[model samples]
Target chain A: MPRYALLVEYDGAPFVGWQRQASGLSVQQVLEDAGASLNGGVPAPTMASGRTDAGVHAEGQVVQIDIALGLSPERLRDALNFHGRPHPVSVVKAAHAPAGWSARFSCTGRGYRYRILNRRARPALQAGRVWHVQGPLDAEVMHRAAQHLLGRHDFSAFRAAACQAKDALRTLDRLDVERQDDEILVRTEARSFLHHQVRNMVGTLVQVGLGRRPVEWPRQLLDGRDRTLAGQNAPAEGLTFLFARYPEGLDWR
Target chain B: MPRYALLVEYDGAPFVGWQRQASGLSVQQVLEDAGASLNGGVPAPTMASGRTDAGVHAEGQVVQIDIALGLSPERLRDALNFHGRPHPVSVVKAAHAPAGWSARFSCTGRGYRYRILNRRARPALQAGRVWHVQGPLDAEVMHRAAQHLLGRHDFSAFRAAACQAKDALRTLDRLDVERQDDEILVRTEARSFLHHQVRNMVGTLVQVGLGRRPVEWPRQLLDGRDRTLAGQNAPAEGLTFLFARYPEGLDWR
Candidate 1:
């Protein structure tokens, strides 16, 4: 058996999430089925770096899979992409991985991007791809407010109730809010995130941007250490799993 | 009647192009209905700078509409966007035009952008928004070939049989092809274009990029003036109406 690392991209609107679930179709099932088609009809399981919520897209999701057949990386990618046809999922790249490597445990950092269409009109081409927020929003204020969550902290305010993580302490590497034309983009990177942490932070920052809350709002929520005292979770459609960074010298493009 | 100029944007996947036809829903009809919603029961008519083909999107399409009510430009824009809900069309901006100004006649230049996803894997997020070319495409050679089609020429080789223009002679101001990662962007600007001109040129450029045709192929096509000898018309979904440039002084922001 050969282990391979795959870089996947997908429009999450069609899948339940990145993981396999009993409820409905998932990105994992689609990839596994594609792998099985090439592996003598034998099941091939896959593991991803993280699990995204439904309707949350991914630009560069890393996954690991084991296959019975030894195929070239390019061939494997092409075959998987062909089998994944009619579905909005693509295998961007494939490479042979070291025997002991893992997609989940070896990942060093993860990045996410959230888009808000901050204009009076609803979106057209970007309808399902962005959060359409009407009225004025000050990105500078949001950026100022986002800095409060930068360093190591107990992020219970931004954690979801359903989050199963044992500890609430994590170091936030970056959180940037910027406006381009009629859009407000929220980008964040960290070693890991609690369930819905990025969405909750964005939702809270939006309140600060709209002048509904002061710039110190996020700091207050962090100090309170209460999820109920924080802002609402931003819609899932606005979020995108940007990328997962691995340590240097991985030898995979 | 107060004549207004509207800056419109839309996802053309669901509509029958920008004109109102007998077959299906159109962007024009959607705008007219949105306009009529605010103008009592009277039907509002509109004229556009250009008529886009089916599945052709728009970023800054300019249209002229006559409304009976005396409302501020922002108010009119908000109202139209409100009524256009559930549809993919949006009025980005609205402003009062000069008494005799026309969106079509007053336009001095038109621009279009064509996107090609040149990769082995099919598109995931940009499915309908780009032309996915599975294999290699030399964008540098394509850019070299595109230059041969610039300047004034008889473009019968690129014009559709159904083109209503009386003459096939037109000035092509710009045609630049460049690649950013796996995507090839073909951008063009001209005083006007014949039916299917931009798409045909892109299709021909792809042929040149794929090594199927020489870099001077477009020059030969230009000289021969034979549409049947040229490459196919690139799909409409890959084309976007970028903008319509007007004369120096215009109050519409």
Candidate 2:
């Protein structure tokens, strides 16, 4: 059997996130159906790098699957896309994965982006894709505050109470906050993250942006490992899985 | 009566377009209802710079309305936005217009943007917001070809058969084409446009991009002035009304 790595993208609004469910559609179920259709009734199981929550989008989600049928990578990509037509999911790229390569363990880093429309008016087409906030925000102050939470640390303050991670310590490689016109985008990269980690960090940053918390609030939250010390979890809709890193020889492209 | 100018933005996906219709929702209908709600009972009639077709979006649509209410400019803007909630339309900016200011007559130039995703797979979240074209496109060739259609010319070849414009000649101020990754964006500016002019030009340029037509196709179409000589009108969904310009002293903001 040959394994292939796929770069997947989805709108997450229609489906119930990436994991398959019995009641609603999922990215996994859609991809499996596409693969089955292309393989003439043979279904394949697909594994993704991250299992995103409902209404959370993915621009460069990585997935891997094995198939016994023989198909060129280009043809397979086209067929999967064709079968997935009319659905808000797409396989943007596909390639043969190196032997024993996996979308999960082979990844070195994962990048995520959260978009916020910092303006008085609500969003239009970007309604569900971004968090609409009224009033002015001091991005410079927020950027300074975000730095205090970067690097290796116990992020329990930003972890959800329901998070099942056995360990709360994680290394955040990078955290950047920038403003583009009326929109503020937060970019982060980490080897791994606990459940609701990103959203919790954003919630704390939002408080700083709104002047409810001081500039050192993030550092203080990190120093305090209790989840009760953090702000509310930001909505999942504003979060997007941007891309995942893989070993050099993994053939991600 | 005091007249005010409104800078509006909207997502055209859910509506039948900018113009009001009895069959389905429209940006006009939504704004009108908001205006009625703000005015306590009187409905305010709004006039826009252009009446875009179905599925066409606008980021900087200019509209003007006359009202006898006591609300300040800022208050009027806030009130409209508050009432406009739950709708995809928004008044991004608002100001008191000059005594005789008009949205349609005071414009100097209008800018339009068309987004094309030239890639192997369809877009996920941006499905309806872009024109998905499979395979590679030569942006340099398309840009060179687009230059031939610039300047003042009779664009009857690019006009739709049902277009109501009496004169087919118009002056194009600027036309630029650029590619970012797998996406191609075309920006065009003109004082006024004939119906379907931008879409038709884009269709012809797409042919040039795909190598289906010669570099001189756009020029030939412009000189021919025969509607049958040009390519089909591109879909309305990919077109956006970027902004409208006015004389420096006459600009509201």
Best by lDDT: 1
Spell out the clash pairs found in candidate 1: none
Model 2: CA > 4 A from native: A38-42, A249-253, B248-253
* lDDT of model number 2: 0.86
User: How high is the lDDT of residue B163 in model 2?
Assistant: 91
Residue B141, model 2: Cα distance from true site in angstroms: 0.8
Number of the top DockQ candidate: 1
| lDDT of candidate 2 over B70-138, digit per residue (tens) | 667777877888887788888888878877778888888899999999888889878889988886889
When candidate 2 is compared with the true two-chain complex, its DockQ is: 0.76
Error of 1 at A113 (Å): 1.1
Error of 1 at B148 (Å): 2.2
Per-residue C-alpha lDDT of model 1 across residues A126-201, encoded as one tens digit per residue: 9889988887999999999999889999999999999999999999999999999999999999999999999999
